[model samples]
Target chain A: MSTLENGTRRSPAIHAPGEREITFGEAIREAIAEEMARDQRIFLIGEDVAAAGSVFKVLVGLLDEFGPERVIDSPISEAGIAGIGVGAAITGMRPIVDIMFGDFTTLVMDQLINQAAKTHYMSGGKLTVPMVLRTTLGASRRSAAQHSQSLHALFSHIPGLKVAMPATPYDAKGLMKSAIRDDNPVVIFEDKMLYQEKGPVPEEEYTLPLGQADVKRSGEDITIVATSSMVYVALEAAEKLDSIGISAELIDPRTTNPLDTGALIQSAQKTSRALVLDEGYSQYGVTGEIASVIADGAFYYLDAPVKRIGAMNVPVPFSPAMEDLTIPNADFVVETAKSLCG
Target chain B: MSETNDTNPSITDLDAEHWLQAYEQMVMIRTFEETANDLYTSARMPGITHLYIGEEAIAVGICEALRQDDYITSTHRGHGHCLAKGAALDKMFAELLGKEAGYCRGKGGSMHIADQETGNLGANGIVGGSAGIATGAGMSIKLRGTDQVSVCFFGDGALGQGLLYESMNMAQLWKLPVIYVCENNQYGEYTHNSKAAAGSMVGRATGFGVHAQAIDGQDIRTVHATARLVIDRARKGGGPAFLVCNTYRFRGHHVGDIDRPYRTREEEAEWAKRDPLTLLEDWLLKSKQAEEHVLERIKQEVKTAVDDAVAFAEEASFPSESEVDQHVYA
Candidate 1:
C-alpha cells in the first residue's frame, strides 16, 4: 500500500488489498499520523480516542505512535474539548481535537460558533485559530439516531469557519493537510460507512484547496450535487441512470462551509435540471442549501424544477432494515433522477 | 538575625513589585469601576454594567502577583480584572460603548472584554464558563514547562457549579499552575453569601489538595501580601492555590438594581465605613509617605485619564451590522 510522503503510516486495507487502495478511514488516520510527526505543535484530545482508538477506529494505534502527551484521552467533556482547543490554539499550539460523533458537536456549539468562530474577527483578525476538529458522520450501521447524523449544514450556516468533507482517500489527505495549515478553525466530517470503502490514492504529500468542488462524473442530462459519503451513492446512482439513457453529472462539494457554489452553479447552468443528494434529514438539510443555490443562481436555466433527495424527517433507526428505508440510497437517487428526466 | 528571620517575609523582588503594582492596579480598577458607575447613572453609557466597585481589591490583589504573560479568566464583573491586566481604558470604554475600537470589536459588550496581548482571557457572561478555561490554561502552562500561572476569578455562586469541581479535580490531578480566587463579596446579585455558600470556600480548595487560604479582601495590603506568598509558591513548582477573599460589593449587581433596600441605609453605612479607597488613603497618609495634595493630584490625574478615555470612546467608530459577517474564522 502507498504511504503519503508526510510520514503517513500505512494502514492494512479495510477491504481487500487489491491495487493498494486505502479506505476513507485509513486515509484520515494517515493524515493525523503524518501531521503529528511533521509538526510538534499538533496534538489530539478526545474521549477514548487513545485506548479505544475512538468509537470508530479512525484513531487506532495513535496512542502507541505518539503517546498520551500528544495523543490525549480526555474525560467525556465536549465542552472541555472546545475550551481546551481554544486555550491550546491561543497558546501557539495546533490541536486536532476529535469529537466522537457529529451530533455531540451541538454540546460544544458555544465554543465552536461563539468562541472559536468569532475569536479571530472579535480580535479584528489579529488572532487566528489553527485548531482542527475531526468528527465522523452517518449511521449505515445500527448506531441509532443520535450517533448517526450529518450536521454539516448547521456549521455551513455559521460564518467564519472552514469545513472539509473529503470523499476520496486522496482528497482526505490533501484536504486534511490544508485544514491543518489553515489559519481559521476547520471542521472535518468523515463518514463512518466510507471508512471501509477503498479507493486508489497516490503515495505523495499534497493539499486540496478549500472552496473547490471536484467533478467526479461529467454528463449532460443532469448535475447531481452531493457531499461527504453521499458522493459515492450519487455516483452509483449516476451510473445506473446512464444505463437508462440519462447522462447525470456528479459534483462533490468537499468543503461545506465555504461551499463550492461557483462550481455547483456552473454545472447546474449546464444541465438545467439538477438533483441535490444529502445524507442529512430533509428539513434544512444540505439539499435545501443546494436547492436554494440552483434556484437563485441557475433559475433561468431550468428545464425542470430542481429536486432534492435526503433522509426522512425522523431519526435514523437502529434496525438495519428501517435504516435502509430512512436514509437515501442509490435506489432513491436513481428514482429521483428518472422522475426528473421524465 | 532573630528579628529579621521571617520565613515568608522576604517577599521576592517580583513579589515586592507585585505589591506596589497591586496598589497602582487597585487605584486604576477603583477609578474605572467608579467611572463606569458615573457614566451608567448619567446615561452616558447605553447598557447595564456590573461594576466591580468594592471587589477591586480582590482582582488587584490576585492578578498583580501573576506574571505579565500568565493568563487570567474573569467573570461578568471583569472590568477591574481587565484593567488590572493593563487593558487600555480607551479600548475598554470603547468596548463598553459598542465601538469598533473595543477589545471584542463591539461584538462582546461589557460582560465579555478580552485582551489576549495582556494575557487577559475574555470575561464570560455565563457564570462558570471561565473555570474550565482557567484549568485548561493552567494545563497549557504546565505542559509548556513554564512557571506561568492562570488565575480564575469567580463568585461564591460559582462554587456550586460542576465546572468548579471538574476543574479543581483536573488541576489537582495534573498539579497545574492555577489560582482559584473566590471573591465571596457578601452577595451573588440578590442572594447573601451566608445563605448561598454551603461550606467554607477554603475547605473546598483544601479538599482538592490545593493550598488554600482565607484572607481579608477589604485590606489591600493583607490581600497583596498573602497573594505574593501563594503566587510565589506556585511559581516554584508548587501546584495550584485557592484564596477566598471575604469582600463586599458597594453597588448593586448591575446598574438597574439598587442594593440599598436589601440592606438598610444604616447597614450600608456600616459597610461604607470600611471603604477600600479610604483604607488605602489612611495607610498612605498615616505612614507619612504622602500628603493630602499628593493624593488629590493622583486622583485628579485619574479623573483626567478617565475624561480622555471617555472622549476617545466617543470618537471611536461602531462596527456596522454587516461587519458581523467578518472574523468568524481566521
Candidate 2:
C-alpha cells in the first residue's frame, strides 16, 4: 500500500494483461464498495439510496452487499442529511451523504457552509469532519431550473470545502476513494451526463490525490484549462484546433480547492496563452477564477489575454434547444480557442 | 437518587450527594452567566454573549441525566449548556475573551464553543442550525451500535424552523437515539413565540410519531426526572423524544440591546418570582434537602471559581495572527 501526501493509503495497482473498462457510474459504485469494505466506519445515507439503489441506479446492489445498516434511505431533507453527515463524521464515522442533485445544495447550504465546513476550525482543530457529500452536476436532462445546475463552482468558492469534479471513470474511482479518506469535508460533483460514458480503469486498488491537475492532452500553441464535463468538450475542441494547425493543451485541475495553480500557470507559461472553460455560469464562476489565476501567474509570458468560456449566465431552461445553447460546448471552446490563438 | 420507575421523580427522592451536586451545577451556571455578563458590559470580553441567566434549570436538569460520552448540540445562548455538560469555566471564559487558552483557541468565541472530550458537537450560531447535526449524531450512535444518546438543545424560537421537524421525522422513522430539548423561553429574540409559532410545540413532534412531552423548565427536579426518563428510553432504542421546557429568559436578547419595550416589567417580575435558581433554593429549603448554610457555601464556591475563571481568561494570551488561517481545513 502506498500513502498519499494527505495521509491516505492507496493499494498498489496490479496491471492485468488488458485493463478493465467500466462506465462512470459503475466505477463510482466500485470505489464506494471498495472503500466501504476496507473501512467498517464508512456508510452511505441519502434519499432512495437503499432499496431504490438511488434514483440514478448508481448505488445498485450496495444495500444488498452492505446490508440496510450500512446503506440508509433518508427522508426528503437535505439540510438534515448534510448536517447529520457532519455530526457523524466528527464523531468517529466517515459518512458519504448523497445529495441527489447539485441544485438541491441550496437546501443544504447552512449545514454544509456553516456547520460541516466550520466545525473543525471552530473547534480549534480539536475536531475534524471526515465526510464526502456526493452529488450530480449537469444540465440537459430536460430537468428545469430547480433540477439542473452546475453548482460545483459555488461549493468551490467556500473556504473549507474541497470540490472535486471527476471527468472520467478512472479519476472518479480514484478521487472517490481519496475523498472518503480525507480528514476534511469534500464535496464531489459528478456530471449526470457522463454516468454512461466508458473509460479504462485498473482492476487493482489505486487512488488519485486531489488538487493534482491531469494533462488530458498536451500541445504548444494555447493552453485550455477545463473541469468536469467540460474536459471532454475541451478535448474535442483540442482535436478541432489541431485540424486548424492550432495545438491546444488540456489541463483538468481535478479538485478546485487546494487547486494546482502551479500546473495551470506552468502550462500557460509554456503555451503563452490560456482559455479557461467550465459548465457553471460565466458570471463569477469557476472559469473566471481559473482565468484570473492564469492571467496573474503567466502575465509576462502570455501573447494574448487569458480568456474564459462558461455556461451562459441564465437559469437552466427545460427546452432542449435553450438548454443546449446555455451549456458550454466543444464548438464554443474551439471558437474561443481560435479567437485567443489568432 | 432513589430508584423509581414512576414518572415525575421529585426532589425529595434525590440523594444528598447528587442533590448537592445538582445545586452546585445550577449555581455554577448562574455565576458563570453573571460573570460573563459583567465581562461583556465592562468591555472585558471581545464579543457579545447571550446570557443564560433565567433558564438554568433546563440545562442543569437535562445535562444531569447525561453521561460524559453522550452527545449534545447546543445553541448561540449556550454557556449554561456547556457548563452543565462539563466544560471548564476557564476555557469558556477564555473563548469569550478570544484567548488562546479558550475551548476553540479563540476562534469560536461565545456562539461556537465545542468540546469533543465531553461529546459536545459545538454550539451553533444559526437558529435551529444544530437540529440536523444532533440527529446525525443519533444516526451515528445507531450505526455504531452504541447506547449513547444525542441531545439537541434549541430555544422556543427554533420552532419556526423546518429543519427541526425534518430531523424529528427521520429520527422517529429510523428509531434513532435522540432527544430534542426545546427550552421554550417564550421568545424568539425580541419577538414573542406566540406570534412566531403556531399550534402546540409538542404536537409538532407528535405529528412525526415521536414520543413527546412538555415539562416545567423552572423545576429542576421535574426537568431532571423527565430528562432521565427520556434519555434512558432513547439509549435503549425507544427512538427520539421531543421535550418542551416551558421557561423564560431574564435578560435582553443580547448584551448590546438593553431597551425593553417588547416586554413589560410586570412580566419580567412574574417570571423572576419563579426564577429557576430561586425555585430550586426554595425547594431545597422547604423539602429540607439541605441546610441554608450548605447552599450558601455552594454559591460562595461557585462565585470563587467563576472569579478565578475570569482571571484566567484575562491572563491568557490571544491567539497569534498566523492562526487565523489555521484549521480552516483539518
Candidate 3:
C-alpha cells in the first residue's frame, strides 16, 4: 500500500467506512480497554487516569467502563506508583502504570531500574514483573525542559526492561497489547506529538510482536532507521529523495532492547548506506547505538560510514524557533541522504 | 522501657505448645546469626552479612501471627524473618554461601534471599526499598478479595525515606491490608534514631491516619499479641497499621563493623540484659509451661539443625557459568 503525503499508510478497504480511522491516542486507549476486558487481572493506576482521564485525554472513557477498582487514581507519587506496579505484577495482577510525563522517569528510576528490572533475575526466575509503564516522549509541544524530553534511551540501556516506541496507530495498539502479555516489564514511550495523528487500525484483534522491525517502505539506494516520531520524518524524507532520483528505505524498530539487528544489518547491506534517527540526545543515545551496530554488521558492504541524527544535546527550549532546531526534521534527513548518496 | 501492659498477652492467653515453639524459633535464630557471624569472622562466608542476633523474638512472634501463605517483605538484616517465615535451613545457608541449592539458585546471596513458597518476598539490600512492594501486595490482596495481610518489615532507618510515607498514604486511603512494622533497634546505621528521625515513628504513620502502636520487641508474647491484633484488623478491612518495635541489635551493624563507637559498652550491656532468647527461656521456666530440661533439649535440637545446615551449605556446589545470562527476563 502506498503512503499518504503525511507518511501514514492507507489501510486496504477491508472494514466498514466508519470503523477505518483512529488516532494514536485512541489506539492506545482501545488496546488497554480491550486487554482489561479480556483479563480481569489487568488494572490501570496513575495520577488523573480515572475521572480526569489523563491530561492528554488518552484515557477519557476507561474510568467509566472499568470503574475505580480497575481504573485507579493515584497521588503524584511516581516512585511509589512504579513500585506498586512492580509489586502487583510480581504477585499476580497486570498493572499499566501511567507516568504522565516521560521526563518524570527520573523520579521513578529506583523502582524501575533497580526493583522492577531486577526482581525476576535476582529471584532467579521465580518472580515475574508483568507490568507496563506508559508514558509520553518527544518535545515539540512547548512543554519546556522538565516536561519535554525523550527518555526512552534511559530505559533501553537497562537489560531487564523492554523499550517500545510505536510510531503509528496500528503499531501503538498492537504493541501495547503485546506489552501487557509480556512476562517481563515493558516501558512504552508514546510520542506526545503523535498522539492525535490519525491512521487506519483494524477493528479485529491483532498484536505486533516485540523486537521485530517493520519496513515502512523499501528502496534500493539507501537505508533509514528511524524511531517513534522520527519514522514520519524519515518517510517524508524518502518521498522527497525519490523525486530527486535518490531512493531511501525506511525501517521502524518498534522495540529497542531486543533490537532487530539482523533486519537493520540486512537493510544496510542491501542499500550500501544507512542513517539512524531518534528524538533522544545525540551523544550516548539510541541513534548512536544503532549506528554502531549497522557499521559493525555491514562494514564490508557499506559505501560510506553510517550516519545518525538525534536531538541536540541540550534541554528543549520553550521558544518554537529554538525548539525546532533541537530535533531531526525531514529536510535535514533529505540533505543527509543526498550527501551519503553523493 | 517496655510499652507492654496488662492488655498484652500473658502466659494465660497462649498455650504451652506455642510457648515451646516460640522458644525454639528464638533459639534457632540466635544460633543461626551466631553461626553466620562465626563463618564471616573465619573468612568462610564469601560476602558481608548483617546479623540478626538480638532481634529474633520480633520475627518469630510476627510470623507466628501470619498464615503460611500470607506475605512479608524483609530488610537488609533479614535472616530471622526468613527462618521465622518457614524457609528451609539448608537452603538458607546455601543461599548465604552462594550455592546452587540456595533459595534463589545462588543468584541472591544473604541480603537478597527470596523464598516464594514461604511467602517471603525477598530481602532487600536497599533500606526501605520493599515498602511499596509490600503495600502493593496489600493492594493486590484487596483487589483479588483475599483475606491475607501483608507485613512490611523495615528498620527505624527507613523512617528517613519518603517512599514509606507515600506507601503509607496509599495503604491508608485505599484501606489496603498492610502492616508497616518498624524494627526500631534504636539506631539507624551509626546514628541513633533520635538524631536521624525528626518526629516520632508512630506519629509519622498516624499523620497518614494509619493505626499506630509501639510495643516491646524483646518480648515475644507482646510482639505476637500486638501483631495478631493489627494483622487481624487489616485483614478485616481496618486498613494499614504502623508498629514501632522497640528492640536492639546485640552485634555491630554488619559482620565487619567491629570497634563500633556508635554506642557505649554500658548501653549494649543494658540492652543485652533483655536478650530475647533469655527472656523467653526465663518466662517458659517461671510459668511452668516448659520444664528446664525441655528448654535445654530444644536448644540441643536447634544446634544440630544449624550444624547440619552449615554442612549442607559447605557441600553444595556453585552455579555453572552457563547460567550467568539466564533469568534476566521470563
CAPRI rating of model 3: medium
- For the predicted complex of model 2, DockQ is 0.81
Residue-wise C-alpha lDDT for candidate 3, range A22-136, written one tens digit per residue: 8889999999999999999999999999999999999999999999999999999988988888778878999999999999999889888888999888888898899999998
Q: Where does candidate 1 chain A have its weakest 10-residue lDDT segment?
A: A8-17
DockQ of each: 0.43, 0.81, 0.78
Q: Which segments of candidate 1 are over 4 A away from where they belong? A: A1-20, B1-21, B105-107, B186-208, B259-270, B286-292, B318-324
Error of 3 at B118 (Å): 1.2
Error of 2 at A48 (Å): 1.1
Q: Candidate 3: deviation at residue B36, Å?
A: 1.1
Between 2 and 3, whose TM-score is larger? Answer: 3
Q: Return the DockQ of model 3.
A: 0.78
User: Which stretches of candidate 3 lie above 4 Å from their native place?
Assistant: A1-19, B1-12
Q: In candidate 1, residue A92 scores what lDDT?
A: 72
lDDT of 2 at A255: 93
Q: If scored against the real structure, what TM-score would every candidate get?
A: 0.89, 0.96, 0.97
Indicate the worst ten consecutive residues by lDDT in candidate 2 chain A.
A7-16
